[model samples]
Target: MTTLQWTPRTDAPRALVVRDGHARLGPAQATEMFLPFLEQAGFEVQVAESSEIYADRAVMERTDLIVQCVATSAISDAALRGLLDAVEHGTGLAGWHRGIADAYRNSSDYLQLIGGQFVSRPAAPDEERGTDESDRSRCYTVDLTDEGRTHEIMAGLEDFTLRTEPYWVLTDDLNDVLATTTYAARPDDPWHRPITSPAVWTRRWGDGRVFVATPGHSLVVLRDAHVRAIIQRGMLWASRPAAAA
Candidate 1:
């Protein structure tokens, strides 16, 4: 692992492109609500309505932090290559909920890169079934692991609750699990066992860093003071140090 020096400001303006075509939430919601959050965090943000531009190598190269708020969708081979290349060369990548975990579902290479995927949930079936954003449930407790407490990204954080989706992820190669949520078995479900699912994690592929959190199913989750702080630190932590790059 390489140590990244903390800087007052990032080198280039970061871009947060919300892919409207594939997102469960429409473009207006993402652009109006989500983009502002990044801009407020001090990044020069741009919201791309479509993913077509991602295919251009030059466009991908110029980006520093690429935040994909899109759900599962097909991407051109060129686009996939471009995004992967940017990360390999030291660009940071961060996303929460299905924006990333479920994005590019068909690409095994993509899944492997991100470290996991959304398969199914047993504890909160009703919340999963509801399409209305308001119908989503909240207020779940997350346990931060030892690894999580030591990391700079998790600095000054403790077990916190967020009004967001409780994620049941299918993962194997998570480098470090910063936080987790416990699930109790329901009568309808076959598995009656309790399991701890990773709520936040970080992985490295080549030179790039990938940080993921399964909590951001709604704007409320994103707006939580603790959640916002974690994401802000995560973006900075995930980016390659300027010297390393």
Candidate 2:
């Protein structure tokens, strides 16, 4: 990743977002958009393409938030363990879509740390890289959980429709699910079941707060007014003191 150009507010918190492995997701658009988004929220941001960013213990210690938007299998065990240690000691961990949960598929330490894993999804169509709106992703709805209605990060957010990948996520009992989506049976994925999976969630890894929004496969979805708000709030929410969580 090249150096991101953004002015920093001295009073703002620091965030490190790692962008690595992504299948069909647009890393370029995501990278381009997220810089201004986090900076505008008062985050002194560092963007790295290497999963090895996890190993920079000094950076991890200074960072208030760590957002990994990388591939599922590219991160190393040492790096994962380093991140896990940092978060346990106080760093916040977060990711949009596969960047958080889907990362480190073979490492139980990574999965255990994040509290969820990306099991599978509706088949993503092949594409030339583009924004979410221009791409026209498969449509789905995002509905808040009962608890989400009053949740500070979700305050004023409501159920909304989006044209994006409706993930069929697998989660553990530890996840505090905030929002979800129901996938209707389709000819392409016809089953007797109408699956409702977590679209947004927050969980604790020791004292470290963790947030995941599994809806972003593009800048289009990520750039949505609601979704962008959720991502910003989610990162800020996680960065707060654990006692407040």
Candidate 3:
């Protein structure tokens, strides 16, 4: 992948948004939805087609925030190192759904940076073989954790229901879990009990911050007021402080 070129700026904080679409969602839709918001927040936003832009060490060093939406893509070693180094040096990283959780399957460092991995979305027991994959989403509730009630990003948000993919993620204690969703095991499920996974989380990686949310599977889900607020706030909360930037 070729590195994207851009002139570095000092007037305002910079945000690097990497967008790549797969299946139902398109980069255009995601960009259209988030670009204006970033700009309005006084950020100098640079849109990239791939994570390869991470290879530009000069730009990455000045970037205050990165909002990536690419899924299931492999990032080159130099690019991956550049990204991790940028974040470790105080750049903020934020993403939603597969964009963060399911991305970079080959890179353990990337996984450690984000602090979560997409595992599986077990189908409902009533779901039949050969069922239309698009309509398989079921309604589930996202309940805030105790810390989430006071956390700046999740404060005052009530438990909300979303009819979308219920992600079962693999995460460690390093994450500061803000919200969660429970998967009730039906009789047919291999696991005999309920399982809960982090629906939203934040982590401190060196001098930087990382934010992840698991509910954004489509444009509709992303448009939900609660979901949108969480993501937007998460981005801001993860961004390098204006003074620091």
Number of the top-ranking candidate, with lDDT as the measure: 3
Q: Against the true structure, what is each candidate's TM-score?
A: 0.82, 0.82, 0.92
**Model 1, which residues run further than 4 Å from truth?**
1-13, 16-18, 26-42, 125-138
Which model is ahead, 2 or 3, in terms of lDDT?
3
Clash count for each candidate, listed in order shown: 0, 2, 0
Task: For model 2, name the residue pairs that clash.
Answer: 21-70, 21-71
The positional error of residue 64 in candidate 1, measured at the CA in angstroms, is: 1.6
Per-residue C-alpha lDDT of model 1 across residues 123-165, encoded as one tens digit per residue: 4554445566455464578889999999998899999876566
Task: Name the runs in model 2 displaced over 4 angstroms.
Answer: 1-12, 123-137, 186-191, 240-245
Residue 94 of candidate 1: its Cα lDDT?
81
Give Cα distance to truth, residue 218, candidate 2, Å: 1.3
Model 1 steric clash pairs: none
Error of 2 at 88 (Å): 0.8
TM-score attained by model 1: 0.82
